[model samples]
Target: MSTALLVIDMLNRYEHDDAGALAESVGESVPNIRRLLDAARQQDSTVVYVNDNHGEWTADRRELADWALQGSRPDLVEPILPSPDVPLLVKARHSAFYATQLDYFLRTHNVDRIVLTGQVTEQCILYSALDAYVRHFDVAVPSDAVAHIHKDLSDAALAMMERNMRARVCLTDELVGVFGSR
Candidate 1:
């Protein structure tokens, strides 16, 4: 099955109330995300980034990246910035599929499965997995590639994704093979 790597909400500003805790987790996640990003690109797999516009209605991908870089964590943003050629859909909500062209884009590209990576393990990742499941898209979320605001909630969310959504909640290393041989 054709698969796409969805980098969700990684272009973050860290200006929110949970930013400190989230940033701590994000520090660990960013490297794994970078590794996956590189692998996906090398294997010629489709890679798309769905990032929050941070309420900037006028923001495009570059603008969002610029804004994120200017925020408290340029170290996090610089490594995983989407390539110019990569399709980036700006999301205003938690679910990447919500009010966005992500579902249609994936359908057009014949992407039946999606590997999710990035910030807020309990929030965006959880919501996106559910939406993907309901839409009949196979979902995989690498544990180490996702950051969480709360450890307990993140753990619970992962469990829900696996038991409820049937998502593959594995490690980053295990998911690298997915980028190869389709």
Candidate 2:
């Protein structure tokens, strides 16, 4: 399968990214995200950062990030920036499928399966997975790599995805095998 790692809503925004929850386990997910990133590297898979483009009103995604960080919307999120190598996709709505070029990029890259990792599982993460499933992409969520408004809701979302959408709710440790490295 052509798998891609989708890091969603890890931007500096409260509505989607976990502003309050970061003091808890969100930092813990970073190492795993990094690990998953390395795994994707070995597998020659795509790494896409699906960020909330508070660009919902005006401007574009980069402008949104700049405004959120440099402007008065500091309460929404803290800066959890991605690496330079990671490709970014600005999502105007909850799901990454909302008027975004995610579909086009996936098609161009021949990405058939997606390994989703990001913040606010109850919202952006869940919505993205649902849309991916609907689009007939194999969806997998590494439980340790995502959190929700609360950890409880995170677990619940994962359960729902596994039971309803038939997604694989995996662990970061299990992600090692997906890499093509020998």
Model 2 scores a C-alpha lDDT of: 0.75
List runs of model 1 lying over 4 Å from the truth.
none
Checking candidate 2 for backbone clashes, the offending pairs are: 14-76
Q: What is residue 157's positional error in candidate 1, in angstroms?
A: 0.2
Measured by TM-score, the strongest candidate is 1
Put down candidate 1 lDDT per residue, 153-175, tens digits, no spaces.
Answer: 99999999999999999999998
lDDT of 2 by residue, 28-146 (tens): 67667778877787777788988876656565556655665664334333434555676887877889877889988998988888888877687888888899999998889998887
Residue-pair clash count for candidate 1: 0
TM-score of each: 0.98, 0.81
lDDT for each candidate structure: 0.93, 0.75
**Scored by Cα lDDT, where does model 1 land?**
0.93
Residue 140, model 2, lDDT? 90
TM-score of 1: 0.98
